[model samples]
Target: MVVDLVVIGTAITLGPLHNSAFILLLTAERGVRRGLVFILSWLAGLLMVIAAVILLTGGTPPARQSVPSTAALAGKLALGLGLVAYGERKRRRPPRPRHAPKWMERPDRVSGWTAAGLAILLQPWAMVGAGAATAVDANLSSIASTLALTGFCVLATSSMLAMELYTTFSPVAAEAKLRGLRDWLDTHQDQAIVSLSLLLGLWLVADSIYQLVE
Candidate 1:
């Protein structure tokens, strides 16, 4: 469970879409406030999912080979296969001219509420689902299990937290660097998505299969 959380957390942190959106928010007018709104919303979404799963399971994993256990693994398997298919399709499709979304162009105009909405909208939900599925195995009675879930949330949100803090403290410096990063992410977003999807998909697929068989 710890291993799964680490991998999924890393993937979420490094995801192109949210990071790109976040960079725009950070560099926009009133960016620090907007960025804070985004980070809080993003963290809230993750917490909600994790809390829901823990509640449903009574904070203990369903027994191995039990129906609930099998179902969780199967759900993860399906999600993994879906990601793999999506990645392959993107990889095989003919390249087209990529343009930044219009919304990205006017980050300065985005309201705090809208920035909050973007956070919810831009989450890598498939990966978040995978994380929730892994959290199924969490035995919260154990300090490690509890800490793992808490740690996973922090780790996943760390990137945005760091960016927001940097921008808040050193606006002039962060703006130039963050804009450069945003442009790079925009240019390479598709490639990043494809790579992340395949790598994480394969990992989830293999791990799910191994657990199911064991």
Candidate 2:
């Protein structure tokens, strides 16, 4: 239970903090409400993945048990390559034109609930990781473990909500920071994405190789 809580908490924190999906969403959207909405959409997407994983793997061994196999290693390598390729593609793409919608330009027109729900749904990796962790804990048939998993999810979500609120309210700071980032991205988007993708791919390859060796 303790282990499950720690793992899940870490996954949730990392997902919101450094996940490319969240960063891309923030980069694309300028307003606080939109940013929140994007996150909610991401979360909602994640929930769908979670539900699917739970339903499919409910009676199966944990992913850790399955992912260390030769087949899994190959799949991970493929996934790593795919991620690298995706990042490279993003880098090569031209900048999109910005056109503000009438609704988006109005501060009072945004829907908070919708945004929250959507953000929760869209981040599929976070959802799957959290769900898998929760499932493993649940399989232990310990009420304490279950409670801890739930607590971790709630705490992580709360932390994200707080951060989003702070970011949204600080328009001047947020805009300034985003403007600087945008300019940087425009000049070095491909290099940045490719570098990150390569690093992540290397990590994946190393992990897979270690699993095979072990």
Candidate 3:
């Protein structure tokens, strides 16, 4: 449960492409419905990862040197190295303006199923994997672990959740504000991804190594 808290903290902090995508989805025709579907899909993906960890560990946190722990640590290391490599690759690319994806341009015609699929597709798999790794330490058999994991899910969805409430409350005013936000998100998306991947990736790699060696 404790490690799960750290995972929640990290999950809440990472601002990925999904943030912008969520906003854009809200700006579309049938925006609310699509946005809700997207969010549910996103949450489901996170839950699926957690479920896998639970099944693997049987609701028990593994010892530092236990097989399950070592496997989880290895998973973290692989994800970290992959993200770091990805970030480095993106960083070395020539400086050029990045454009919004075609899906982002006109969310109006996007079907609900597409929006749902987009959530899963665009989910930060590496980061989510890291969370899943940490969740290996959560004892799902305990009520506390259940609560903590539930909390993690809510925190992970915090940003988009806020936007949904905002749009529902103030539709007209929200559009102008979200449009501006959406544009900034588009322009900076790549840089943001690179920075996050590099930073968190390094942290995950270091922590995994420490756990494996210490």
Best by TM-score: 1
* Candidate 1 overall lDDT versus native: 0.93
* The 10-residue segment with the lowest total lDDT in model 3: 4-13
Any residue pairs clashing in model 1, and if so which?
none
- Considering TM-score, which of the candidate structures 1 and 2 is the better prediction for this target? 1
Q: What is the TM-score of each candidate against the true structure?
A: 0.97, 0.52, 0.90
| Comparison by TM-score, 1 against 3, better one | 1
In model 2, where do residues sit more than 4 Å from their true spots? 1-30, 59-71, 84-163
List, residue by residue over 50-152, the lDDT tens digit for candidate 2: 4554465463435554642355456655655665677667667776665533543443444666445445544435223434434442442556654654565
Candidate 1 structure quality by residue, lDDT tens digits, 23-141: 98888889899999999999999999999999999998999999999999999998899889999999998889877778777889999899999999999999999999999999989
In the order shown, the candidates' Cα RMSDs to the true structure are 1.1, 6.6, 2.1
How much lDDT does each candidate structure score?
A: 0.93, 0.50, 0.82
Q: How do all the candidates rank in terms of TM-score, highest first? A: 1, 3, 2
Against the true structure, candidate 2 has what lDDT? 0.50
lDDT of 3 by residue, 1-214 (tens): 4663465346544575888888888988879889899989999998998998889888889887988788988998898899899989999997786665787667898898999999898888778878888889888678888888887878888888888888989989888899899889777877887888787778878888988899
- Please count the clashing residue pairs in each candidate, in the order shown: 0, 23, 0
Candidate 2 displacement at residue 68 in angstroms? 9.6
Alpha-carbon shift of residue 129 in model 3 (angstroms):
1.1
